[model samples]
Target: MTLTLRQPSMLTGMDIPSATQPTPEPAIHVRGLEKSYKDLRVLRGVDLDVARGSIVALLGSNGAGKTTMVRILATLLRADAGTARVNSLDVATRAADVRASISLTGQFAAVDEILTGRENLVLIARLRHLKDPGGIADDLLARFSLTEAGGRRVGTYSGGMRRRLDIAMSLIGNPPVVFLDEPTTGLDPQARLEVWQAVRELAAGGTTVLLTTQYLDEAEQLADRIAILHEGRIVVDGTLGELRRLLPPATVEYVEKQPTLEDVFLTLVGAGTEQGQR
Candidate 1:
Protein backbone atom coordinates (compact mmCIF):
# COMPACT_ATOMS: atom_id res chain seq x y z
CA MET A 1 0.00 0.00 0.00
CA THR A 2 1.16 3.53 -0.79
CA LEU A 3 1.36 5.58 2.40
CA THR A 4 0.81 9.31 2.24
CA LEU A 5 1.98 11.39 5.21
CA ARG A 6 0.28 14.68 6.02
CA GLN A 7 -0.67 16.63 9.14
CA PRO A 8 -4.30 16.41 10.16
CA SER A 9 -6.34 19.52 9.27
CA MET A 10 -8.06 19.62 12.67
CA LEU A 11 -8.92 17.39 15.62
CA THR A 12 -11.35 14.54 14.87
CA GLY A 13 -15.03 15.61 15.24
CA MET A 14 -14.17 19.08 16.59
CA ASP A 15 -15.40 22.21 14.87
CA ILE A 16 -13.11 25.18 14.38
CA PRO A 17 -13.03 27.51 17.36
CA SER A 18 -14.96 30.72 16.94
CA ALA A 19 -13.07 34.01 17.33
CA THR A 20 -15.07 34.94 20.44
CA GLN A 21 -14.64 31.61 22.22
CA PRO A 22 -12.12 31.25 25.03
CA THR A 23 -8.94 29.39 24.15
CA PRO A 24 -8.77 25.86 25.44
CA GLU A 25 -6.17 24.98 28.06
CA PRO A 26 -3.15 22.97 26.99
CA ALA A 27 -3.29 19.20 27.38
CA ILE A 28 0.08 19.33 29.16
CA HIS A 29 1.58 22.20 31.09
CA VAL A 30 4.87 22.35 32.95
CA ARG A 31 6.51 25.22 34.77
CA GLY A 32 9.60 25.59 36.94
CA LEU A 33 10.25 21.85 36.80
CA GLU A 34 13.36 20.89 38.66
CA LYS A 35 14.98 17.54 39.42
CA SER A 36 18.29 16.64 41.00
CA TYR A 37 20.45 13.63 41.79
CA LYS A 38 22.13 14.92 44.93
CA ASP A 39 24.19 17.75 43.43
CA LEU A 40 23.68 16.74 39.79
CA ARG A 41 20.69 18.60 38.45
CA VAL A 42 18.75 16.94 35.63
CA LEU A 43 15.95 19.41 35.02
CA ARG A 44 16.26 23.08 35.92
CA GLY A 45 13.05 25.01 35.81
CA VAL A 46 11.99 23.73 32.38
CA ASP A 47 8.79 25.18 31.01
CA LEU A 48 6.67 23.71 28.24
CA ASP A 49 3.11 23.30 27.03
CA VAL A 50 1.46 20.91 24.59
CA ALA A 51 -1.78 21.81 22.88
CA ARG A 52 -4.73 19.40 22.93
CA GLY A 53 -4.82 16.82 20.13
CA SER A 54 -1.37 17.91 18.92
CA ILE A 55 1.99 16.15 18.87
CA VAL A 56 4.82 17.94 20.65
CA ALA A 57 8.31 16.52 20.15
CA LEU A 58 10.94 17.04 22.83
CA LEU A 59 14.28 17.05 21.00
CA GLY A 60 17.38 16.52 23.06
CA SER A 61 20.73 14.80 22.92
CA ASN A 62 21.79 12.02 25.30
CA GLY A 63 21.60 13.06 28.98
CA ALA A 64 19.72 16.21 28.09
CA GLY A 65 16.91 15.51 30.59
CA LYS A 66 14.35 14.43 27.95
CA THR A 67 13.45 11.22 29.75
CA THR A 68 13.47 13.03 33.08
CA MET A 69 10.90 15.49 31.83
CA VAL A 70 8.70 12.76 30.40
CA ARG A 71 8.81 10.74 33.61
CA ILE A 72 7.75 13.77 35.63
CA LEU A 73 4.89 14.50 33.27
CA ALA A 74 3.77 10.87 33.17
CA THR A 75 3.62 10.80 37.00
CA LEU A 76 6.23 8.04 37.12
CA LEU A 77 8.65 10.45 38.79
CA ARG A 78 8.07 13.55 40.85
CA ALA A 79 9.77 16.90 40.35
CA ASP A 80 11.77 18.55 43.10
CA ALA A 81 10.27 21.95 42.50
CA GLY A 82 7.65 22.61 39.85
CA THR A 83 4.19 21.87 38.66
CA ALA A 84 2.95 19.64 35.83
CA ARG A 85 -0.61 19.22 34.73
CA VAL A 86 -2.07 16.67 32.29
CA ASN A 87 -5.57 17.20 30.93
CA SER A 88 -5.80 20.07 33.46
CA LEU A 89 -5.22 17.72 36.41
CA ASP A 90 -2.05 18.37 38.42
CA VAL A 91 0.31 15.45 37.98
CA ALA A 92 1.52 15.82 41.55
CA THR A 93 -1.76 16.38 43.37
CA ARG A 94 -3.69 14.06 41.08
CA ALA A 95 -1.19 11.38 40.19
CA ALA A 96 -3.86 8.71 39.85
CA ASP A 97 -6.01 10.92 37.66
CA VAL A 98 -2.99 11.82 35.52
CA ARG A 99 -2.13 8.13 35.14
CA ALA A 100 -5.71 7.40 34.17
CA SER A 101 -5.59 9.99 31.41
CA ILE A 102 -2.30 8.97 29.80
CA SER A 103 -0.33 5.99 28.46
CA LEU A 104 3.47 5.77 28.57
CA THR A 105 5.49 3.86 25.97
CA GLY A 106 9.16 3.62 26.72
CA GLN A 107 12.27 3.37 24.52
CA PHE A 108 11.80 -0.40 24.05
CA ALA A 109 8.79 -2.53 23.20
CA ALA A 110 7.23 -3.91 26.39
CA VAL A 111 5.57 -6.97 24.86
CA ASP A 112 5.68 -10.46 26.36
CA GLU A 113 7.72 -12.40 23.82
CA ILE A 114 6.19 -15.78 24.74
CA LEU A 115 2.65 -14.54 24.12
CA THR A 116 1.03 -14.08 20.72
CA GLY A 117 0.33 -10.53 19.55
CA ARG A 118 -3.41 -11.03 20.14
CA GLU A 119 -2.75 -12.46 23.59
CA ASN A 120 -0.70 -9.47 24.66
CA LEU A 121 -3.39 -7.00 23.65
CA VAL A 122 -6.10 -9.08 25.27
CA LEU A 123 -4.11 -9.29 28.47
CA ILE A 124 -3.85 -5.53 28.67
CA ALA A 125 -7.53 -5.08 27.85
CA ARG A 126 -8.52 -7.54 30.56
CA LEU A 127 -6.23 -5.83 33.07
CA ARG A 128 -7.90 -2.53 32.23
CA HIS A 129 -11.26 -4.23 33.01
CA LEU A 130 -12.62 -3.72 29.52
CA LYS A 131 -15.42 -5.87 28.12
CA ASP A 132 -14.80 -8.44 25.34
CA PRO A 133 -11.05 -8.56 25.47
CA GLY A 134 -11.00 -10.74 22.34
CA GLY A 135 -12.85 -8.13 20.34
CA ILE A 136 -10.60 -5.39 21.66
CA ALA A 137 -7.53 -7.39 20.63
CA ASP A 138 -8.87 -7.99 17.11
CA ASP A 139 -9.79 -4.34 16.60
CA LEU A 140 -6.31 -3.11 17.63
CA LEU A 141 -4.60 -5.81 15.56
CA ALA A 142 -6.38 -4.57 12.44
CA ARG A 143 -5.84 -0.94 13.37
CA PHE A 144 -2.09 -1.49 13.55
CA SER A 145 -1.97 -3.87 10.57
CA LEU A 146 -1.09 -6.93 12.67
CA THR A 147 -4.25 -9.00 11.92
CA GLU A 148 -2.49 -11.73 9.94
CA ALA A 149 0.20 -12.16 12.56
CA GLY A 150 -2.09 -11.83 15.56
CA GLY A 151 -1.83 -15.55 16.36
CA ARG A 152 1.96 -15.69 16.02
CA ARG A 153 4.18 -15.45 19.07
CA VAL A 154 5.52 -11.94 19.64
CA GLY A 155 9.06 -13.36 19.57
CA THR A 156 8.54 -14.21 15.90
CA TYR A 157 7.58 -10.65 15.04
CA SER A 158 9.88 -7.98 13.65
CA GLY A 159 11.00 -4.93 15.60
CA GLY A 160 8.37 -2.69 13.97
CA MET A 161 5.57 -5.16 14.54
CA ARG A 162 6.42 -5.51 18.21
CA ARG A 163 6.52 -1.75 18.65
CA ARG A 164 3.22 -1.35 16.85
CA LEU A 165 1.64 -4.00 19.04
CA ASP A 166 3.08 -2.32 22.13
CA ILE A 167 1.44 0.93 21.08
CA ALA A 168 -1.85 -0.80 20.29
CA MET A 169 -1.84 -2.37 23.73
CA SER A 170 -1.35 1.06 25.27
CA LEU A 171 -4.58 2.26 23.64
CA ILE A 172 -6.67 -0.28 25.62
CA GLY A 173 -8.88 2.33 27.29
CA ASN A 174 -8.27 5.11 24.74
CA PRO A 175 -6.29 7.35 27.09
CA PRO A 176 -6.38 10.89 25.74
CA VAL A 177 -2.68 11.60 26.25
CA VAL A 178 0.30 9.40 25.30
CA PHE A 179 3.92 9.74 26.33
CA LEU A 180 6.27 8.12 23.81
CA ASP A 181 9.78 8.23 25.18
CA GLU A 182 11.96 7.56 22.17
CA PRO A 183 9.54 5.05 20.61
CA THR A 184 11.58 4.60 17.39
CA THR A 185 15.08 4.54 18.85
CA GLY A 186 16.51 1.35 17.36
CA LEU A 187 14.23 0.39 14.47
CA ASP A 188 15.42 0.20 10.86
CA PRO A 189 14.32 2.79 8.30
CA GLN A 190 11.12 1.05 7.23
CA ALA A 191 10.25 0.22 10.80
CA ARG A 192 10.80 3.81 11.82
CA LEU A 193 8.41 4.88 9.08
CA GLU A 194 5.84 2.40 10.32
CA VAL A 195 6.01 3.85 13.85
CA TRP A 196 5.84 7.34 12.41
CA GLN A 197 2.58 6.49 10.64
CA ALA A 198 1.17 5.04 13.84
CA VAL A 199 1.99 8.25 15.72
CA ARG A 200 0.32 10.31 12.99
CA GLU A 201 -2.83 8.23 13.37
CA LEU A 202 -2.85 8.98 17.12
CA ALA A 203 -2.92 12.74 16.53
CA ALA A 204 -5.55 12.33 13.83
CA GLY A 205 -7.76 10.52 16.31
CA GLY A 206 -7.54 13.43 18.80
CA THR A 207 -4.97 11.87 21.12
CA THR A 208 -2.35 14.24 22.46
CA VAL A 209 1.20 12.91 22.16
CA LEU A 210 4.42 14.06 23.78
CA LEU A 211 7.25 12.34 21.92
CA THR A 212 10.83 12.45 23.15
CA THR A 213 13.41 11.80 20.46
CA GLN A 214 17.07 12.37 19.61
CA TYR A 215 16.20 12.12 15.92
CA LEU A 216 15.91 15.62 14.44
CA ASP A 217 14.19 14.41 11.30
CA GLU A 218 11.62 12.48 13.33
CA ALA A 219 10.59 15.75 15.00
CA GLU A 220 10.33 17.46 11.62
CA GLN A 221 8.22 14.65 10.21
CA LEU A 222 5.83 14.19 13.14
CA ALA A 223 5.73 17.09 15.59
CA ASP A 224 3.21 19.90 15.36
CA ARG A 225 5.59 21.76 17.71
CA ILE A 226 9.27 21.05 18.35
CA ALA A 227 10.99 21.89 21.64
CA ILE A 228 14.76 21.70 22.02
CA LEU A 229 15.96 20.88 25.51
CA HIS A 230 19.50 21.75 26.46
CA GLU A 231 21.09 21.57 29.88
CA GLY A 232 17.75 20.67 31.46
CA ARG A 233 15.69 23.47 30.00
CA ILE A 234 13.65 24.14 26.87
CA VAL A 235 15.66 26.69 24.90
CA VAL A 236 13.48 26.86 21.83
CA ASP A 237 9.99 25.72 20.86
CA GLY A 238 8.00 26.30 17.66
CA THR A 239 6.71 24.79 14.43
CA LEU A 240 9.20 23.52 11.81
CA GLY A 241 8.63 26.53 9.61
CA GLU A 242 9.13 28.85 12.55
CA LEU A 243 12.39 27.08 13.48
CA ARG A 244 13.55 27.35 9.87
CA ARG A 245 13.10 31.09 10.03
CA LEU A 246 15.80 31.27 12.73
CA LEU A 247 18.44 30.73 10.03
CA PRO A 248 19.20 33.26 7.32
CA PRO A 249 17.02 32.93 4.22
CA ALA A 250 18.49 30.72 1.49
CA THR A 251 20.09 32.39 -1.53
CA VAL A 252 18.59 31.57 -4.94
CA GLU A 253 20.48 28.79 -6.68
CA TYR A 254 20.06 26.66 -9.81
CA VAL A 255 21.57 23.41 -8.50
CA GLU A 256 19.70 20.30 -9.58
CA LYS A 257 17.87 18.52 -6.75
CA GLN A 258 18.49 14.86 -6.01
CA PRO A 259 16.30 12.39 -4.13
CA THR A 260 17.45 11.63 -0.59
CA LEU A 261 18.25 8.10 0.59
CA GLU A 262 14.88 8.06 2.36
CA ASP A 263 13.06 8.95 -0.86
CA VAL A 264 14.88 6.19 -2.81
CA PHE A 265 14.28 3.64 -0.05
CA LEU A 266 10.57 4.38 0.17
CA THR A 267 10.20 4.27 -3.62
CA LEU A 268 11.86 0.85 -3.82
CA VAL A 269 9.85 -0.48 -0.88
CA GLY A 270 6.57 0.77 -2.34
CA ALA A 271 7.41 -0.81 -5.71
CA GLY A 272 8.24 -4.12 -4.05
CA THR A 273 4.98 -4.07 -2.07
CA GLU A 274 2.97 -3.37 -5.24
CA GLN A 275 4.66 -6.24 -7.10
CA GLY A 276 3.92 -8.60 -4.22
CA GLN A 277 0.25 -7.58 -4.34
CA ARG A 278 0.06 -8.20 -8.09
Candidate 2:
Protein backbone atom coordinates (compact mmCIF):
# COMPACT_ATOMS: atom_id res chain seq x y z
CA MET A 1 0.00 0.00 0.00
CA THR A 2 2.94 2.32 -0.54
CA LEU A 3 2.41 5.48 -2.58
CA THR A 4 4.80 6.95 -5.13
CA LEU A 5 5.15 10.33 -6.68
CA ARG A 6 4.25 10.99 -10.32
CA GLN A 7 6.20 13.51 -12.36
CA PRO A 8 3.71 15.98 -13.84
CA SER A 9 5.62 16.50 -17.06
CA MET A 10 6.12 12.81 -17.70
CA LEU A 11 2.54 12.19 -18.93
CA THR A 12 -0.88 13.81 -18.84
CA GLY A 13 -3.51 11.10 -19.07
CA MET A 14 -5.95 9.21 -16.83
CA ASP A 15 -4.47 5.72 -16.28
CA ILE A 16 -6.97 3.16 -14.98
CA PRO A 17 -5.10 -0.08 -14.45
CA SER A 18 -6.40 -2.79 -16.79
CA ALA A 19 -8.67 -5.24 -15.04
CA THR A 20 -7.73 -8.93 -15.03
CA GLN A 21 -11.32 -9.94 -15.77
CA PRO A 22 -14.77 -8.51 -16.43
CA THR A 23 -16.03 -6.60 -13.40
CA PRO A 24 -19.13 -7.58 -11.41
CA GLU A 25 -22.10 -5.45 -10.20
CA PRO A 26 -21.68 -2.74 -12.77
CA ALA A 27 -22.71 0.69 -11.55
CA ILE A 28 -24.31 1.46 -14.89
CA HIS A 29 -25.77 -1.05 -17.31
CA VAL A 30 -27.45 -0.80 -20.69
CA ARG A 31 -29.47 -3.40 -22.53
CA GLY A 32 -30.38 -2.93 -26.16
CA LEU A 33 -30.45 0.84 -25.77
CA GLU A 34 -31.26 2.31 -29.15
CA LYS A 35 -31.79 5.86 -30.38
CA SER A 36 -32.64 7.30 -33.76
CA TYR A 37 -33.33 10.59 -35.48
CA LYS A 38 -35.43 10.48 -38.64
CA ASP A 39 -33.91 7.66 -40.69
CA LEU A 40 -30.51 7.58 -39.06
CA ARG A 41 -30.29 5.05 -36.25
CA VAL A 42 -27.56 6.42 -34.03
CA LEU A 43 -27.60 3.75 -31.36
CA ARG A 44 -28.41 0.18 -32.35
CA GLY A 45 -28.69 -2.31 -29.55
CA VAL A 46 -25.87 -0.78 -27.58
CA ASP A 47 -24.92 -2.68 -24.42
CA LEU A 48 -22.41 -1.67 -21.81
CA ASP A 49 -21.71 -2.19 -18.11
CA VAL A 50 -19.49 -0.14 -15.84
CA ALA A 51 -18.63 -1.76 -12.55
CA ARG A 52 -18.68 0.09 -9.28
CA GLY A 53 -15.44 1.87 -8.37
CA SER A 54 -13.93 1.22 -11.81
CA ILE A 55 -13.33 3.44 -14.83
CA VAL A 56 -14.82 2.30 -18.15
CA ALA A 57 -13.84 4.05 -21.36
CA LEU A 58 -15.79 4.26 -24.61
CA LEU A 59 -13.47 4.59 -27.60
CA GLY A 60 -14.99 5.01 -31.02
CA SER A 61 -14.65 6.63 -34.41
CA ASN A 62 -16.50 9.80 -35.31
CA GLY A 63 -20.26 9.21 -35.81
CA ALA A 64 -19.92 5.94 -33.90
CA GLY A 65 -22.58 7.12 -31.44
CA LYS A 66 -20.55 7.43 -28.23
CA THR A 67 -22.03 10.78 -27.30
CA THR A 68 -25.55 9.58 -28.08
CA MET A 69 -25.12 6.68 -25.71
CA VAL A 70 -23.89 9.00 -22.99
CA ARG A 71 -26.86 11.27 -23.47
CA ILE A 72 -29.29 8.40 -23.02
CA LEU A 73 -27.52 7.21 -19.88
CA ALA A 74 -27.51 10.72 -18.48
CA THR A 75 -31.28 11.08 -19.01
CA LEU A 76 -30.68 14.08 -21.24
CA LEU A 77 -32.35 12.11 -24.02
CA ARG A 78 -34.62 9.12 -24.15
CA ALA A 79 -33.89 5.96 -26.05
CA ASP A 80 -36.09 4.84 -28.90
CA ALA A 81 -35.93 1.31 -27.57
CA GLY A 82 -34.23 -0.71 -24.83
CA THR A 83 -33.34 0.36 -21.32
CA ALA A 84 -30.50 2.05 -19.41
CA ARG A 85 -30.00 2.06 -15.70
CA VAL A 86 -27.73 3.94 -13.34
CA ASN A 87 -27.35 2.20 -10.01
CA SER A 88 -30.28 -0.03 -11.11
CA LEU A 89 -32.63 2.94 -11.56
CA ASP A 90 -34.02 3.16 -15.07
CA VAL A 91 -32.91 6.36 -16.71
CA ALA A 92 -36.21 6.75 -18.56
CA THR A 93 -38.73 5.66 -15.95
CA ARG A 94 -36.90 6.73 -12.81
CA ALA A 95 -35.11 9.79 -14.07
CA ALA A 96 -35.20 11.57 -10.73
CA ASP A 97 -33.60 8.65 -8.93
CA VAL A 98 -31.15 8.03 -11.73
CA ARG A 99 -30.08 11.65 -11.87
CA ALA A 100 -29.72 11.87 -8.14
CA SER A 101 -27.23 9.00 -8.26
CA ILE A 102 -25.24 10.18 -11.28
CA SER A 103 -23.56 13.28 -12.60
CA LEU A 104 -22.87 14.09 -16.23
CA THR A 105 -20.17 16.51 -17.38
CA GLY A 106 -20.80 17.10 -21.03
CA GLN A 107 -18.08 17.89 -23.55
CA PHE A 108 -18.25 21.58 -22.68
CA ALA A 109 -17.71 23.13 -19.27
CA ALA A 110 -20.94 24.55 -17.84
CA VAL A 111 -19.80 27.16 -15.33
CA ASP A 112 -21.79 30.36 -15.00
CA GLU A 113 -19.80 33.32 -16.30
CA ILE A 114 -21.20 35.74 -13.73
CA LEU A 115 -20.44 33.59 -10.71
CA THR A 116 -17.05 33.11 -9.10
CA GLY A 117 -15.68 29.59 -8.72
CA ARG A 118 -16.86 29.37 -5.11
CA GLU A 119 -20.22 30.86 -5.98
CA ASN A 120 -20.75 28.39 -8.77
CA LEU A 121 -20.24 25.43 -6.48
CA VAL A 122 -22.32 27.05 -3.75
CA LEU A 123 -25.14 27.53 -6.18
CA ILE A 124 -25.10 23.90 -7.20
CA ALA A 125 -24.93 22.82 -3.55
CA ARG A 126 -27.96 24.88 -2.73
CA LEU A 127 -29.87 23.36 -5.62
CA ARG A 128 -28.94 19.91 -4.38
CA HIS A 129 -30.29 20.81 -0.93
CA LEU A 130 -27.00 20.04 0.71
CA LYS A 131 -26.40 21.09 4.29
CA ASP A 132 -23.76 23.73 5.00
CA PRO A 133 -23.56 25.33 1.58
CA GLY A 134 -20.51 27.35 2.62
CA GLY A 135 -18.64 24.25 3.73
CA ILE A 136 -19.38 22.42 0.49
CA ALA A 137 -18.11 25.30 -1.61
CA ASP A 138 -14.92 25.58 0.40
CA ASP A 139 -14.25 21.87 0.20
CA LEU A 140 -14.80 21.80 -3.57
CA LEU A 141 -12.49 24.77 -4.09
CA ALA A 142 -9.79 23.26 -1.93
CA ARG A 143 -10.12 19.79 -3.43
CA PHE A 144 -9.90 21.13 -6.98
CA SER A 145 -7.03 23.51 -6.09
CA LEU A 146 -9.18 26.57 -6.73
CA THR A 147 -9.12 28.08 -3.22
CA GLU A 148 -6.66 30.79 -4.27
CA ALA A 149 -8.57 31.97 -7.36
CA GLY A 150 -12.05 30.93 -6.31
CA GLY A 151 -13.04 34.52 -5.58
CA ARG A 152 -12.47 35.58 -9.18
CA ARG A 153 -15.36 35.42 -11.60
CA VAL A 154 -15.54 32.17 -13.58
CA GLY A 155 -15.33 34.15 -16.82
CA THR A 156 -11.95 35.46 -15.71
CA TYR A 157 -10.59 31.97 -15.17
CA SER A 158 -8.62 30.01 -17.73
CA GLY A 159 -10.21 27.22 -19.74
CA GLY A 160 -8.63 24.63 -17.46
CA MET A 161 -9.70 26.44 -14.33
CA ARG A 162 -13.28 26.69 -15.50
CA ARG A 163 -13.31 23.01 -16.35
CA ARG A 164 -12.06 22.09 -12.89
CA LEU A 165 -14.78 24.14 -11.30
CA ASP A 166 -17.40 22.60 -13.53
CA ILE A 167 -16.31 19.13 -12.50
CA ALA A 168 -16.28 20.07 -8.82
CA MET A 169 -19.78 21.47 -9.07
CA SER A 170 -20.94 18.21 -10.63
CA LEU A 171 -19.92 16.43 -7.44
CA ILE A 172 -21.89 18.66 -5.11
CA GLY A 173 -24.09 15.71 -4.17
CA ASN A 174 -21.33 13.07 -4.45
CA PRO A 175 -23.12 10.85 -6.93
CA PRO A 176 -21.85 7.34 -7.49
CA VAL A 177 -21.76 7.30 -11.29
CA VAL A 178 -20.22 10.17 -13.27
CA PHE A 179 -20.38 10.41 -17.05
CA LEU A 180 -17.77 12.62 -18.70
CA ASP A 181 -18.47 13.12 -22.39
CA GLU A 182 -15.22 14.23 -23.96
CA PRO A 183 -14.29 16.23 -20.89
CA THR A 184 -10.89 17.15 -22.31
CA THR A 185 -11.89 17.80 -25.89
CA GLY A 186 -10.96 21.46 -26.19
CA LEU A 187 -8.29 21.73 -23.48
CA ASP A 188 -4.70 22.50 -24.21
CA PRO A 189 -2.10 19.92 -23.23
CA GLN A 190 -1.79 21.10 -19.63
CA ALA A 191 -5.49 21.66 -19.12
CA ARG A 192 -6.22 18.22 -20.47
CA LEU A 193 -3.92 16.76 -17.86
CA GLU A 194 -5.65 18.62 -15.08
CA VAL A 195 -9.02 17.19 -16.08
CA TRP A 196 -7.53 13.74 -16.36
CA GLN A 197 -6.10 14.01 -12.86
CA ALA A 198 -9.49 14.98 -11.48
CA VAL A 199 -11.06 11.98 -13.19
CA ARG A 200 -8.42 9.63 -11.79
CA GLU A 201 -9.00 10.95 -8.31
CA LEU A 202 -12.75 10.49 -8.72
CA ALA A 203 -12.33 6.86 -9.69
CA ALA A 204 -9.88 6.24 -6.86
CA GLY A 205 -12.48 7.61 -4.48
CA GLY A 206 -14.74 4.69 -5.54
CA THR A 207 -16.93 6.51 -8.04
CA THR A 208 -17.82 4.59 -11.19
CA VAL A 209 -16.81 6.49 -14.32
CA LEU A 210 -18.06 6.17 -17.89
CA LEU A 211 -16.07 8.43 -20.18
CA THR A 212 -16.12 8.98 -23.94
CA THR A 213 -13.12 10.47 -25.67
CA GLN A 214 -11.65 10.85 -29.12
CA TYR A 215 -8.20 10.62 -27.57
CA LEU A 216 -7.11 7.00 -27.48
CA ASP A 217 -4.26 7.78 -25.14
CA GLU A 218 -6.75 9.17 -22.65
CA ALA A 219 -8.74 5.94 -22.63
CA GLU A 220 -5.60 3.81 -22.41
CA GLN A 221 -4.48 5.79 -19.42
CA LEU A 222 -7.77 5.91 -17.52
CA ALA A 223 -9.97 2.97 -18.53
CA ASP A 224 -10.16 -0.30 -16.64
CA ARG A 225 -12.01 -1.73 -19.67
CA ILE A 226 -12.05 -0.33 -23.20
CA ALA A 227 -15.00 -0.70 -25.58
CA ILE A 228 -14.83 0.21 -29.25
CA LEU A 229 -18.09 1.29 -30.83
CA HIS A 230 -18.48 1.03 -34.57
CA GLU A 231 -21.66 1.83 -36.48
CA GLY A 232 -23.63 2.04 -33.23
CA ARG A 233 -22.58 -1.35 -31.91
CA ILE A 234 -19.67 -2.52 -29.79
CA VAL A 235 -17.14 -3.97 -32.19
CA VAL A 236 -14.54 -4.76 -29.59
CA ASP A 237 -14.37 -4.76 -25.79
CA GLY A 238 -11.41 -5.65 -23.59
CA THR A 239 -8.34 -4.31 -21.84
CA LEU A 240 -5.65 -2.35 -23.71
CA GLY A 241 -3.40 -5.38 -24.12
CA GLU A 242 -6.38 -7.47 -25.17
CA LEU A 243 -7.46 -5.09 -27.89
CA ARG A 244 -3.85 -4.61 -28.99
CA ARG A 245 -3.63 -8.38 -29.32
CA LEU A 246 -6.82 -8.47 -31.41
CA LEU A 247 -5.47 -6.32 -34.22
CA PRO A 248 -2.21 -4.74 -35.35
CA PRO A 249 -1.74 -1.63 -33.23
CA ALA A 250 -1.40 0.41 -36.37
CA THR A 251 -1.54 -0.23 -40.12
CA VAL A 252 2.06 0.76 -40.82
CA GLU A 253 4.83 -1.34 -39.33
CA TYR A 254 8.30 -0.10 -38.51
CA VAL A 255 10.73 -0.23 -41.42
CA GLU A 256 13.54 -0.78 -38.93
CA LYS A 257 14.07 3.00 -38.73
CA GLN A 258 11.30 4.23 -40.95
CA PRO A 259 9.62 7.63 -40.96
CA THR A 260 7.95 8.81 -37.78
CA LEU A 261 4.37 7.70 -37.23
CA GLU A 262 3.35 11.33 -37.64
CA ASP A 263 3.41 11.24 -41.45
CA VAL A 264 2.20 7.67 -41.71
CA PHE A 265 -1.06 7.21 -43.56
CA LEU A 266 -3.74 6.66 -40.90
CA THR A 267 -6.74 5.76 -42.99
CA LEU A 268 -8.81 4.48 -40.04
CA VAL A 269 -7.49 3.52 -36.63
CA GLY A 270 -9.02 3.18 -33.20
CA ALA A 271 -8.74 6.46 -31.33
CA GLY A 272 -6.38 4.77 -28.84
CA THR A 273 -3.93 3.08 -31.21
CA GLU A 274 -0.29 3.99 -30.53
CA GLN A 275 2.92 3.54 -32.48
CA GLY A 276 5.74 1.04 -31.77
CA GLN A 277 3.34 -1.13 -29.79
CA ARG A 278 2.30 -3.42 -32.59
Off by over 4 Å in 1: 1-21, 269-278
- Candidate 2 structure quality by residue, lDDT tens digits, 70-179: 98898899899998878878899989878877888988898899988888988888887877878888877877778888888888887888888889887777777789
Please, what is the TM-score per model? Answer: 0.88, 0.81
Q: With candidate 2 superimposed using the best TM-score fit, by how many Å does residue 238's alpha carbon deviate from the native?
A: 1.2
Give residue 9's lDDT in candidate 2 (0 to 100): 18
lDDT of 1 by residue, 77-163 (tens): 989998998888899998987887788998889999999999999898888777788888888887787888899898988888889
Error of 2 at 120 (Å): 0.5
Give me the candidate number with maximum TM-score.
1
Candidate 1 has what TM-score?
0.88
User: Each model's C-alpha lDDT?
Assistant: 0.83, 0.78
